[model samples]
Target: MPRYSDADLLEEIRRVADVADTDSAPSLQNFRDHSDIADTTVLRRFDSWNAAVVKAGFEPNDPQQRIPTEDLIAELQRLREAVGHAPTIDEMIEQGNHWPSTYKRRFGSWAEALDAAFDDINGEAVFESRAETEPDDPGTPGPHVSGETLLEDLRALADELGEPPRFKEMVEHGDHRARTHTKRYGSWAEALEAAGLDPDARSGGTQQVSTDQLLADLRRLRDELGRVPTATDVVEEGTHGIATYQRRFGSWSDAVEEAFEESDA
Candidate 1:
């Protein structure tokens, strides 16, 4: 093996420090001191100096090659334990920031870094679990369950009913509100509907309605329908009033029946 001059060896140490620093390219002074290449000699083996630097664990010019600053600091501490020496503050900062790309920077992706940094100060590295489906497939957005928003609507419906129904049953019955219902109750539709949504009528289109309109209609049916005639009777009693009700209250039995009669031909 060809032996490097004293200056060449110094340059190698400088390159090592630079890599162990933040992967900034080793300076000309570093090369001058650390390698066999003499300033005055024929420059035949300049390329060899590069290879030597690589062997010394210094990457040349890679932007993303992050030095393991924390690990390096720990090692520096360990060195201090025996050799009574460690890098100064500037050196520590240099080691942590701005790395070269030629070397493998960190172990995992950005998400892994975030998980490790923000979650646990002493956390061990963890690889991400692979997704079961291919990326292009229309799979579930996240872990599957009835959406929480739908469940909240269900809860609101239950409150309108003045008692919780068996929400799970209602959900199982496939009411439009079932998703909302399922979130408040356990993941069961029957349980949610049973929470007291009267899924039989609500789910069946016996009372065709959106959630808020349904609540209002339920209240009207309980309170005002008895005072008036059937909803149909009330509708026929006033065209403008029925239109107004349809506009404000959504669908109703009377309006539905009248429309069906008009279209029956």
Candidate 2:
């Protein structure tokens, strides 16, 4: 194998850190496995794997940094401005300055952190906004929609689209905002499950299929169709569905190629 440059190693570390679970601190083994860079190389390059991770924009693996609540709120606002909308948990985890789990821990949940951020941005308390926007009757559904109602809306939207909408699609076209569902049900996938749909099929929450299972499904589709399976075909016919394959392998074409390679082997 060729020797990796320092810049190349750092870039790979950042790539791995970007997708790793935010709930846990990243390790040398994580960098090694995800980047194909040996742990010895990382340690030799930066004196420690944590040093390399720090250069990659991840929080240091020392005593967990206690981000001030005000700073967390500001980071949320910054993300909202950058994205032109309220940031989702996944968005925050992927793009925000702080970890999504940190925000959740500081505010008791991601929804509450968002509420605080929104309130700070609008210069009012959450209840004040509720008072201004909500109807007189507590029973009436308004901006602060209940979890059950949000689930119903999700089902209705799915029915309209013939499949569950991704988070961006739901934000652009659905009746309720994505933030509303997250606030009510903890995450969109949770809301989706509450609505009696496959959560993995809709939101890219957790991987519902292993790599072996996804490859098997892809091969099965190929055998049945006698050709490569498109994303639509996976959505309509595959066992774990299109979202599962997409999450596992990045895209339909990638999944098809992987399946073919496995079959050839």
Candidate 3:
């Protein structure tokens, strides 16, 4: 028998090893069945199947296993170079078609598939904004207007008006600007604050939720529910199930307390 050379047998073994998944290993029996190499020649090189697999460039249990796709591409590219030929776009397309299936099997969705394919071709995926994102919602307006312009405008308006015009006089005379400010702010105190006045400094008093009142409310809720109220319950009841609760009371304690309050009530 014209026995196959060691180099040819090794190359064939490497090709099979390349296609096998991380969980699989190549065997001498498979080689005998698939290739024209004789068992006698294969036995001469490898003492065992494990030895043959190791020779074909793989550890028995490598955690960081690489996919054979790139290696296969590299081999094909090398062959093309040897024959003075360049792979065409159609050939690349045919090859690229395998990427989605390969990616989906590894990752579980189309988005993940695209991400993996992106990594293979370009080392990283480009960011894709969701279709629902609104283009016109620029954050917080212009810094010039947002931070300083409003204050500047208020200061300018105050300077132009001068000496804090009497709101009672304006209301009696039905001054349009005074009427507009009163309508928007509800009172002179609110209007003064909007124009950047320190009402507390002038009045010298403090306003706060009394601890006794808070305790009374909590006790009432707990008694009604036969349990303590949660933050979520308080927020939901207080805010009428508005999403504002999530913003204010972000802890489990708050939700529990609110829940208890509602239950007790």
Candidate topping lDDT: 2
Q: After superposing candidate 1 on the true structure, give the runs of residues whose Cα lies further than 4 Å from its correct spot.
A: 1-247, 250-265
Candidate number of the best TM-score: 2
Residue 261 shift from truth in candidate 3, angstroms: 89
For all candidates in order, the CA lDDT equals 0.36, 0.61, 0.39
How well is each residue in 48-153 modelled by candidate 3, as lDDT tens digits? Answer: 4456667767554321233455543454354335433332221222222222223334456434433443333321222123212322222211111232333343
Give the Å error, residue 231, model 2. 12
Task: Tell me the tens digit of each residue's lDDT in model 1 across 39-123.
Answer: 2121233333344445445665432333354553344444335433222221222232221111123534333333333333221
lDDT of 1: 0.36
User: In what order do the candidates fall by TM-score, top score first?
Assistant: 2, 3, 1
The better candidate by TM-score, 1 or 2, is: 2
lDDT of 2 by residue, 30-81 (tens): 6544643334446656766567778877777752354567788898889889
